[model samples]
Target: MNRIKTDWTKPQKLSLVALLFIIGKTIKESWVLILYFIVRAFVKQNEDEDDTEKRSDKLIYFLLLTAAFLIFFQIQKFIQFFKTRIYIKDNELIEQTGIFTKKTKTIPIHKIQSVHLVQNYIHRFTDTCTMKVETAGTEKTELELSAIDYLKAQDLQEILQQKEAVSAANISDNNSTQLMGLSNFDLIKLAISENHIRTLSLIFAFAMSRLDDLRQFFGKKTDAIIDEQVNQINFTTSIVAGMIGLGIAITLAFSVIRVLLRYNDMQLTANQKGFKVKWGFLQTQQKMMLQNKVQLISWNSNFVRKLLGIKILRFFMVGENILKDDQYIKLPVLQEDVLKKLSAYYQPVWPSLNENPNYTHPSYAWRVTMIYILPVAFAASVALYFWEPWVMIIPILLFLYFLVTFKIRHMKFIFWYNQTSLQIQKGIWGDEHILLNFKKVQHVALETSPFLRRKNLATLVLHTAGDSIKIPYIPLTKAQAIADRCLYEIELDKS
Candidate 1:
């Protein structure tokens, strides 16, 4: 095994600013605010002096203090940086570092599931990036290089992949063929199809919650101006129209910019190991997943995508996808051939209903989900009974909700088990297929309530390292059979 230390380059030093928001060390992170308070204290002490002279002195003192504190802080960071080290020995990736308390971490190279490089807005200014090293069985990164040279990070990533390749005997995809690449025109189409209202609502919520921070960063008082304008207007007359128009304009602008920058000229390629995607305009990222490392493969589509005949294929990788919520290896607006290629790489282990016609949820499964909705509906109707004409719309919505739930829950809620894998088909608005191999199953839970016990119905839950799959409203006998089979498969694999 070979070993090396970080170069500790100039860009890494500048990246300290980025770490202010990240890295939750209370004392070290609070330095800037501390410096501001110290300056304020110094200014307050000299309050007896003349106002003009005091103001000049305060400005000078604040600048001097800011410079001194930052200089000392950088020196401290430099010392810590110099002490930081990375090395490999005996099939282990070792990282040793810490300021006051030294910490050493040794991770088996084989256990390294995913290597991620993350860069946000601050990374643009620093010309450096973060290397997140995650392993199986954990949501947190095992080791993280917060600020490292971008090229060096890539070199390290290649080295890790090479090591993993040696271990798994699959380094890259053999075909080395381009799977999909989004052109500018395609990106434009994506921008048009995006659901701006939902995006805008998220933006509005975040902005409302973080107005002070945004004001400090962007130096725009328009938020205050808008608030004043809204308060001036009549509450019920045209507020909805005005807010919607503003939201639409903001959403459209944000959607266009976001699509162009985030998904600009994105490309996906397949090699011997698995597939890798390279995307982003200003700040580029390369995300790859190996077949062995992928725990799950799922896809989703909104109304726009369904209309456009496109889908986003998401990779539920074991070690690499630690974020859990956000998919790193996502192919957006996947064309036909790419979908076929993806399916070929990751086929469903579970057989379709055509192959196993007997294992399906009963018609009462529709009412299983309705059990959750009726209570809420009763409360809503009672709450809104005073609002007569307006309340009439609620029942219409309630009917639609029940109709959709009934249509989805009863018709396609199916699960089939074979010796190799279990297949689950679910979802209402979108088609979601889950294939769980026996080896990947972490645990199996077979549950039955009083009602389910009375009806001989049960719910089966299968947990993996990444996520859980639940099959609700199946016959108890079937649930028990599946659970026993899962345990039997686990024992077989072990033996």
Candidate 2:
């Protein structure tokens, strides 16, 4: 067993106080702004003011309000800092915080879902990181330790890991006769089935777009000069050359920055117990996932990434939402062959070979496409009454083409099931692969639209924790059978 004691430094405490002040100011000013607007609306005499007078008054009022809010918030923050102390004792984590309330929470090692060490530019400069520990719950009850030295952060992580191992062993010994385990091969399949490259490419493109926006905002003058130069290159050849040069420069800059920011010292490993991830540039983070805690798995690939042979894998754990953290354990980039091998371990239920099974949708796509087409065609017909009738032809043709694409895409859907899991694969341009444990399904629904009812076809939807997945175009009887089987499986698992 190991122990670590930690506290915030004076500067770090000031930073935390500043953060609280900002929050308080924002909240306080929000109500003030609303009230000021309402009061101003009644005082119409003041509306005829010179612009300079109005601006000056606004600035003075804002500064005064903010200063008062900050002064009060800083006092509250100082009291909080004086009261809080965090320390790890052997296999248990403890947080003793609060001024007048005097609250203390102790989380045993086994309950911690994940530990995250985060640092921004300021924290990096100070060689410290914020340690956050998540536990099992729907509420955002995270324990945060701010401004811990980098070496101390690493030492705490090791201590937590040791406690986790001991707790896991104890639980396994106690429950060995009752629990069913997911095999190492299953984890491997999960890793492989994820579309790593596609996911990475999408991530890269998004980062590049954001960076481009930031640059444009900060380098407005430089951008204006570049635009003038670009416009001056009037020759067709020179224009093409200029565009190509700009594109290449942007792409190279984006790629290097993205690789450095995201995958600096990236690592991924797996064991029979769980998956492990270590990544980051300034504040190295370690994330561990116990096999049983994983609730669902998904893989997604957009059209661009699919063309480039890339895919992204996502794991939904039992209690926490990955979207909140905005950090995912990634393979970074992987070849198709490597993906195939990893997919087998992570997503064994997915078919190894591409199966061109006939895909069918309930009448929903047709309804949606017709709904889209009717409006455009109606508008076009109305327009032709006043404008060129020829304009109608172009819109009519485009609408028809769009409708056809929707129909074709919606007609492509497939669902598969085995004794242990239900697999669903669907999408038009970007495919979505979902794997759900049959036991976790809360309920099953069989529904039919008017058209489907006429056709004697129905859809089956399985409801889980947060969302539901549907399988369409099955016969009514078959849909009922699937629903029944799912319900039985859920019951059996519970029993």
Judging by TM-score against the true structure, name the best candidate: 1
Q: What is candidate 1's TM-score against the reference? A: 0.75
Off by over 4 Å in 2: 1-69, 87-93, 105-112, 121-127, 139-141, 149-237, 244-248, 282-284, 319-330, 336-358, 362-365, 375-385, 388-394
RMSD to the native, candidate 1? 6.4
Backbone clashes per model, in order?
Answer: 8, 25
Instruction: Summarize candidate 1's per-residue lDDT along 337-371 as a digit string, tens digits.
Output: 67757756666433663457434456454564467
Write candidate 2's Cα lDDT for 1-495 as tens digits: 755443322122323433444455556756765566667668765446689678967876986687677667656656666666666665667777677788888887677766677776667767767777767655354677665666666666655654575566533321211112223343333333434555457667887898688777877675677679878866798878997787655655555555455556656555434556666665566565554455567777666556555556666665665566443454533355545444444455453234334355546567776777778777877787578766777777777787777776666567666556667777786777777776667788888778788888887888765357777777787677668777888889778
Tell me each candidate's TM-score.
0.75, 0.65
